[model samples]
Target: MPRGSALSQSLIDTAHALADAARAETLAHFRNPGLDAANKAAAGFDPVTEGDRAAEAAMRAILAERRPGDGVFGEEYGITRGSSGLTWVLDPIDGTRGFLSGTPTWGVLIAACEGTRPVYGIIDQPFIGERFEGGLGVARYRGPQGEAPLRSRQGVALKDAILFSTFPEIGTAQEAARFREVSARARLTRFGMDCYAYGLLALGHVDLVIEAGLQRYDIAGPIAVIEAAGGIVTDWQGGPADEGGRILAAGSPELHAEALALLSGTAAEGAA
Candidate 1:
């Protein structure tokens, strides 16, 4: 869609509305002592709480009412096909672990996608009263201090960059080794920020976020936001990361190339 077209505005408005509705549902269960979780994983612990369900349901309700022709794909509910060819991809609470731990790093991810590509997206942290938006000619951050343009830090070298990832283990043992190759060279490396790390990348506070074993919802929103902020997000092979596996996000192409070389074991002696 054209950046400032009527459809673009309408979709943007609906995205904010969906975020608002999700905020209420998620906040209601955020730190509730009575809140409990169910394990979605069989081998280890992958938790899903009422907050995830309720928040997604609330957003779906708004989509069904206002954008009935658009499709919906959410973490909790799977997919609901529509004729418009645009899907609203949602991860009601991107970090269930963080939410369960009562940390503010968990966020609600909302993205309007055309096929596999996100055209507009929002990363919202309800507890922090912050929202990062991008795509459709929009790249902005709105929070307690007020709204501001979102711009990724430019010309950062990998050795001087700060990096983030949700888990120290990353994907598999080999993937973890690849991650360590990059982390070993970074000026600073932090873990466990979930989607909020992407928000920080958009705000230029961080330079890179690498992860693996993600779903479409895990990355679509962040991809839109970070790309809008003039950053780059792709798989380790420098391919599309929208479908979600082994993502490498960097604030600048220089950083991206340097990190990509390390991740892929293709770095020259003095590359980047």
Candidate 2:
């Protein structure tokens, strides 16, 4: 339960291993001419490629062998419940659209949860060799360049912050309006980075990330990474984000409070 305990280290190592195994599987199918991409959404064009299935399957295999009693929840495959309180969450290719479009921003997400709380997480971008890992009291970035400690920016003002969202049309009418409210006040706003945006936030390159219509797998890994890096992550209403719809992450507590006030419409526009 305490930070940096033996159990935490073991879970972190397991997360890295799972991400490594998934990276291999996703790389094989990524951007291949023969890669089969199909729509998984009922009425819209939500894509699922062979890479997604293969990568998740690969990670599931490792979990089955190494943490046999742990539960597994993956995007491609359905849930495999385990008696152990730990549940491994997998999103083989987080930015599937980016991957299909040959963008290197896609990442493999792996997280270990004890009950409803995430204890460890890793965001692995194999193509670029960047791995952002965090849990309990530790967060770090590892890549071909080198490894370094991670910390969020301090004293960031809301009006001067950089913001990101996966897409503008992602959520309902109200959610879109809420996002617009925050984006309008930020110094700059960018779109289409997917989960990669969260990693950038944790690294202090970006200051805020607000998005809606997300599942648990989408934010669990990033939430752990961001929080461990000293950022705040919560639902738009400033509640727990573990269930994942309408989430907000900020580099500092002051910034987070400012964003939440705007998001909740408690602070009028142009209010200091």
- Give candidate 1's total backbone clashes: 0
Whole-model Cα lDDT of every candidate shown, in order:
0.95, 0.87
> Clashing pairs in model 1?
none
lDDT per residue as tens, model 1, 165-241 = 99998899999998999999999999999999999999999999999999999999999999999999999999999
Report the error of model 2 at residue 223, Å: 0.7
lDDT of 2 by residue, 158-197 (tens): 8999999999795888778878888889999999999899
Q: How many clashes (backbone atoms < 3 Å, residues ≥3 apart in a chain or on different chains) does model 2 have?
A: 0
Candidate 2 regions exceeding 4 Å error are 1-4, 269-272
lDDT of the structure predicted as candidate 2:
0.87
RMSD of 1: 1.7
